[model samples]
Target chain A: MDLLLEIAQQVINGLVIGGIYTLMALGMTMIFGILDQTNFAHGELYMLGAYAAFFFSMVLGIPYLVSVCLAILVGVLLGLMYEWLIFRPVRGKDPLNAVIASLGASIFIWNAALLVFGGAPREIPTPFLGEKVNLLGVSLNVQRLLALAVTIGIILALYWWIGKSRLGRAMRATAQNREVAALMGIKIGRVAELVFATGGALAALGGALVGPIFLLQPSMGLLAVGKAFIVVIVGGMGSVLGAIYTGFGLGVLESLTVGFLSSAYRDVISFAILILVLWVRPQGLFGRTGERGG
Target chain B: MKTLPYRNLWKWVGTGLLLLIVPVLVRDPYYLHLINMSGLSILLAASLNLITGFLGELNLGHAAFYGVGAYASALLTMRLHLPFLLTLPVASLLAAFSGALIAYPCLRLKGPYFAIATFGYGEIVRLILHNWDTLTNGPLGLRGIPGPAGFINSKVEYYYFILTIVALSLLAIWRLLHSQLGRTFWAVRQDSVVLAEMIGINSTRVKVLAFMVAAYFAGVAGSLYAHYLRFISPDTFSFLESSTALAMVIVGGLGTFWGPVLGAILFTWLPELLRSVSEYRMIFYGLLLWGSITFLPQGISGFLESRIRKNCTTGVARDAHS
Candidate 1:
């Protein structure tokens, strides 16, 4: 009965963390779908977001919600800068150029963060602090619970916005075909900028949400984005819905792995999923076949 | 006309003499180490050029193949007590075999998908090396690895030894590029779907062989690094190393024979040169990478060759669509 409860507790814990991964993966899916360039600097963006929230909340004494919004705003601006500076020129010239550039951008940003932050991790002072609330048998942190609630709320808001907003419609058209969208007077460049910003916002929100849980560090982006990449790939390249569900699935799978197997097997499982999905089933679980961007 | 031939021959001999005499000229241990590392970098970048530049596959997991070679060589040396000379070929073959297996599945995917798969594989290899304590000694790293025996024990000798390997590998690669098989690689790169198949190129086999050849040299690099450093760890073969190697190839110029050498030199020497201002060093490195890829995508060699050759290049057509 104790073992079963532990497993159940782990499941709930996994779902909470999964909420963060889902938010980040949505940004990745959006950026990749619209830009056709995998923003390898995404993890850095997440790190920046966390730092932004930490600065706003802890240093400036701003409210948690307001700081989170600041993080999102910062992320969107950074995304626009990345698009203008890195993604725009190398968009169609060479397939590998954009990817390599992104890698450089990642290294640059991570190191810059290191230079600025000085490598020591800072803890965000959230409203809930470390206070835990017991639910049945499982004890959960109030901060984590609030973060999870915010994640679900934002995701729902995103879905509605995508469905209803004019900008969302324009983004959809751009994703389908950039040149044709331009031909149809959709302003592909503006759509790209918007998509980058939206992706950045999502990633920032995820980072800010998890800032209190995981201490703000320059390298925090590396593990988060790496896992998110696996989720995005496993969910299929261009499928946002697939990324969300796979994000949760991976989190649960990881928690279960820790519960049943060993923590060492975590990397083994993620890579295995990445390899198997890509090699055996490149179409992915939910992605449609015959569409591959660059 | 006869004197012109002799002059070119003399030029070759002069350059050869200079290369041979570099160790003697630079007796400083650190400089010797830099030269030695530069050779390994050349070997790595050249090997990658075969796949990414010549073969048109963006393999981001090269360090894994390199790690495999290093571990395979280190373990074999420790267990079997084989000479380092013999271990070189053995390590190369082992890496090649693994390369063939990876390439089989890896070649099925296109572009970014292929890059991700390879990156994933590299991480898996590194993770295994980090976790499998019994074999790899885990994160503690394998210590007390012996260098080559006899007169080659000296750092200068070791540098020359690695240089010899680099020379041979470069020669082999150059010869391969000049052969019919090289033409087949060109065909495969140009259009693997139609022209490659239509030309009886056996595109898949060619690609796998290119990858194997690349891995073979990468193994050579690994084995040398293992014996040189005399310590092996999973951290040595991280994604950062792979990207740095690829960056060397890119900065050197992709699809050019001499490009990797130029790139290898820059990659090895630049960081060492910038070690004084360590804080701002990576920023500079990153900017260089970003700038090179964005502006001079063809790289230094490409820029030079384009200026000299003036649109008369063979193999890949620049701006195939436009």
Candidate 2:
């Protein structure tokens, strides 16, 4: 019974982390679904958001929530620039070229961050610093709770936007088949822009929420990108719902593994799951076979 | 065509002679070490090209093989007192095994999925290297790996040794490209499902073969690197390292034999030359990669070929290589 309670507690902790993963993966999936290219640098966009928010809160003394909005704005603008500067020119070339370009963008962002921000970790000034919430005898940090709440809010808003709005429907249509959607008079380029910006926005939100939880650093995006890739794969390539579910699943699994198993193998666990899921069920739990995803 | 063969042979001979005389001319240990690093970079990049260029898979986990080879050989030579020469083959074999392990699940996926899967596999290798402290010494790294047979006694000697490895690996790739397997690789790359199946070529087997061969040389590069540097660590082969290797291939020109070689040399030298301004180095490197891909899609060698021939026929020739 005690062990069960411990496991449950660990699970709640996992949920908090999972929420962040869900946001990051959602953004990545949106861009990948529309662009048919993986932004290896998506995490860098996330990183940019974190640094931007960090600067805003630390230097300008902006509130945490307001800093998050600033992070989203930065994310959207950077994402637009990435589309214009990186993916736009390589658009119609071999998809592999885009991959390389994304890699270059990733390196540029990562190294540029390293150069500008330095290697040291920076603390994101959070309003919830040293605040804790007691939930079922488990002490949860208030920052974690706020982060989770923000994630849920973003997911709900995204669902509404995707479900109700005309642009959202158009984005979904574009995702289903870019050529057909274009043929149907959808502005493919505009849709691409919207998706990229939204992707960036989501990633920024994730980064802002996470900055307060984990100390900020230039390389923070690398691990987030890796884990986001895993969640996307396990959740099925372009399925937003799948990404959310798998994100949470991976988070819980990671927490349980760290709690019961060796902490050292936690990363290995994700990689192993990636390989296993590919071998056993490449389509993922919710994915349709032969779907149009890379 | 008649003069082409003669000119190419002379060019090869000239380059070979140049490589031979460089050590004697520039006796500086730092330059020699840099040159050796270039040779290893060439090997790693070219090996990556075997998959991305020929096999047409955007695998993101190439550093896994390189790191595996380094750790595997480093352990053997340092712990068991095995000859460095022997450990090279053993380490490569270990890398090949891991390559084979990673390939089966990943080969089924296309495009970005393949890239991410390989990337994940790479992270798994790095994780093992980080956590498995007893064998890898964890983050502290293995030190004092002796050079090959003690004949590689100095930086120049080690430079020559690595140069030999790079040359042989290039020769192997060249030969492979001219063989039936090379054609099969192109066929698979063109369209894995239809043409390969029509020709009764197992696309999976061909991809795995390319991966194995690539892993072999990457391991060999890792082995040489470990012996030369006399140190090994998990951080040495990060995801960033894998991205760098991919950049070298892309910047050098994918699918061309000489492109990655030139790219490796230039990239290795460029960053080293910027050692004083190290902070801005990566930003420059990243911009270079972006600019090259955007401006020169076919890469430096490809551009040169087009300039000389006044046509893109060489690209076609590369595709239809015998």
Candidate 3:
């Protein structure tokens, strides 16, 4: 009985963190899927979102809810800048060039943040801080619950739009073949803009949601981006449903490892799993073979 | 027959002499230390270029081999009391073995996936070093590592020691790059694996060989660094270090023989030049990486090579007109 309760509690915790991973992975997979480029600086967008939220709510005295929206807005602008400045220039070239450029941007932003914000970790206070709800003999905090709810809502809306909307179909087409889609009258630039903006907004939302829960540090995005990459790969790059499922699954697995084993083994275990997965299925579980460039 | 470029040979000889006299010319211990560090960085960048610049596969775990080499060499000297010469080869071989272990599983992955896997592998290696307290001493790292003394005690002598090793390694790399195996590496990078396979080339074997050789050279550099600095830590071999090495290769000119050498020296000194506003150093470094990669994709060495070619062509045209 005790073990069951413990497992349940761990699962709840895992789901919350998993939601954050899914949000970040959603953005990453979309960019890779449509633009055929990897954003090594994707984490910076998440980091910036957290900083922007902290600035708006804590420093500027804006409400937390409104700050989240504003942070997403900031993410949209940054995403557009990334497309124009980094990804656009390296388009159709060696895929690795884009990776290197984004990596440079990541390093630049991370260091700039360090100089500006200092190395000290910052926390954003929220009304949901200590509130809790009891279910199945387990207590869960309001802030985490709120994050989970927002994550689910965003995922659902994104799913519906991508599945049913015309623009989403255009995105899928572009992902299939960029040249063919462009020749068929799909505006590649507009699609790219939309994809990047969406990616940025999603990643920012993740940072904003998780800010009140965990202390916002400059290096948080680095670790977060690492986990998101694992999720994107395991879910198969460019597969939305794959990312959604794998994100939560990995979260639960990690929470269980931490709960049952030790915190130190969390990264080791996840990375080992990644290597194993790649060894068995190089294209990822949900990824189609030869669907994209190596 | 490929005729040797005699003019370039003279230029190399002149540069070699200058490098040999650097310690005497710059008597300041601080400058010599920077030069030695540059030698080690060049070694690292050159080895990494084998896999990244030549093989066209981004191995984010290059630093793992470096960390392994450093720890192995340091441990051999500290615990086993082995001589510097013996430990260097043994430790580097250990690192090479680890490279093979990773490459065997990872060679099938292409492009970004390959990079991601290597990144994961690198983190795993670092985590092991961080957690395996008994072997690695955990995050505190190993200190008081012995230097290559007895024969080479002074800092100046150590500079010569590193210079000799670096020069030999570069010569070996240059020779390998011009060999048949090196040509195979270039073919694998320039063409798809399917195409290469159709021509009866085992692309996987070629990649693994490149990875092993690269790891071996990185190990040599790491062993040198472990002895010189007299400190060993997991932090030194983090993802940032790997990226810095990659930056050296890219900023120098990928796949170019002399590019990483120039880049290593420039990067080594750039930080010292920015010591006044050290806080802004990384920001500047990041800006340089982005700007260079975006604006000057071919890198500085490639740019210079192009300029020289243009001038030569124009010189010919002017002479013909006359």
Candidate 4:
């Protein structure tokens, strides 16, 4: 049957680029499971929330659903100015000094967006960029079924706001034990500034839903923060549905290794499956080998 | 305990004769190419301050073992012609055999899972030196090379041949940080389970001998930066050159022996004195690496060694009350 409908249209274009790498590895595995601090400028705040939804739908023309809620309110006001000017004065210092001050605020917001948006790349326009559909006989691409229906409606509204809110049970009691979530009363630095402003508003709604379909630049947040750190190290660093099932199983195994190997070894097969899953499961894939310290 | 005191051996032979007569009184081949690019960024910020400031370990892919010792001394001196002082000890033994083969399965993971498994083995060695390009010519990198000729072709003989290989790798990392195996690698960085119960000392063989002596002085500063900028590429060892060699070992203060030479001479002359804010030079190098980790976290040589240990404990308590 036409090679099972061309391997089900290359597994629905590798589950719509693994539903935009599971909405940019669900805001980098919920700010590395409540601020263990990777945020190496969380892919330059998902390239400044796709240039704040491309300057709100191509320079204030608006309505691409109100420029994806104004690129998640400018990625929650640049994740509350990166937790009020860099992680509330280096919270509990020496997590390698907040990973070298979030890699010097991701090389100062990618060289201040290469000095106010210049290192080229741009393009936004979406409303299903030159649509397409078909179905059984296959064909696809209505912007990869609207990026798999906005990544299954933002992974079922971040699994009902992280399993029914109360600020998601004080961000799962401050990621299990921030001094037993500050001795139960919670307020562990306002649940790490509401998990770094809901992980910089879900990495600026995954750079305003993968900026139309990949263009915008300023070094496109270093290969979407190195494939969202190989989908939060093969989905484990404090799980969030194992970074949405290992960011759609590493975006359908890097779109079946760029359709049968060699899109210049598709980011060397996702950095050799992130150094062979940190040499065979260094507590990833839903971690918990004694939640090895932050 | 006070043995080696001929006035501290004439202050270590007058600081190795003022680092061999201050590059022959400033010969100025653009200040000996900014003192041979601050002796290859003080041998990559003193071997990334011996794996993140003397083994507290947070190696976010130390410029992938200084770009695997500058592509193994630029492919053994451009396709096996060798002899740049035998391709600097075969690019510091192929960057200490790829830092003891990625520190024997990543020092069996610790903190930030060994800094995201050495930032995924420095982006899988810069994506196999950018798609192997039939042995790295991929990103059109490796270029001319050949420099360190007879007496290293001038610029005051390659600034006294990279200041005699950065004073013999800073006197073999100050004799492996003043050995008794450098106090069991500073008691496995202060307290690896009380230096494995008061001194049995293994702490994973002193963190794989401080990650093979900081990947053998970052493969002799990537074989003197592939014989002084013959040319290299993989965007000159990115991860923003391992976050400017961990911001010159945390703004030059971490574990102090002249804090990665005053944080590799003020983060390589503060991007050449903010090259006239050439387009907000990386937003003032990200506001001087977030204002030197938010207000000098013990940097400027640990704020001048805690004001010279508070003026030598108030001059030995006013010379014991006179």
Q: Which candidate is the best by lDDT?
A: 3
lDDT of 4 by residue, B1-322 (tens): 2122355698879977987788778866776688788889988888878777767788888888888888888788778888788888878888877888888787777766687778778888887897788888878878887776777677777777788878878767766776666656656764464645565877777788788888878888887887787888898887778877877877777766668877887777776777777788667767677778888976677777667768786532110011
Candidate 4, A54: how far from true, in Å?
Answer: 46
lDDT of 3 by residue, B115-157 (tens): 8899998999899999999988999999999987798898899
- Please state the error at residue B208 of candidate 3 in Å: 0.5
What lDDT, from 0 to 1, does candidate 4 have? Answer: 0.77
CA deviation > 4 Å runs, candidate 3? A291-294, B1-9, B314-322
Q: After superposition, how far is residue B11 of candidate 3 from its true place, in Å?
A: 3.0
lDDT of 3 at A267: 90
Among all candidates shown, the one with the greatest DockQ: 3
Reference A-B contact fraction recovered by candidate 4: 0.71
Give the best candidate by TM-score: 3
DockQ of each candidate relative to the true complex: 0.73, 0.74, 0.80, 0.26
Candidate ranking under DockQ, highest first, comes to 3, 2, 1, 4
Model 2: residues >4 Å from true position, as ranges? A1-5, A292-294, B1-7, B190-193, B311-322
Give stretches of model 1 more than 4 Å off: A291-294, B1-8, B190-192, B309-322
lDDT of 1 by residue, A170-260 (tens): 7777778888888989987788888788888888888998898888889888778788888888888878778878988888889889878
Classify candidate 3 by CAPRI docking class.
high
Ranking by TM-score: 3, 2, 1, 4
True contacts kept of each: 0.71, 0.75, 0.77, 0.71
Alpha-carbon shift of residue B138 in model 4 (angstroms): 10
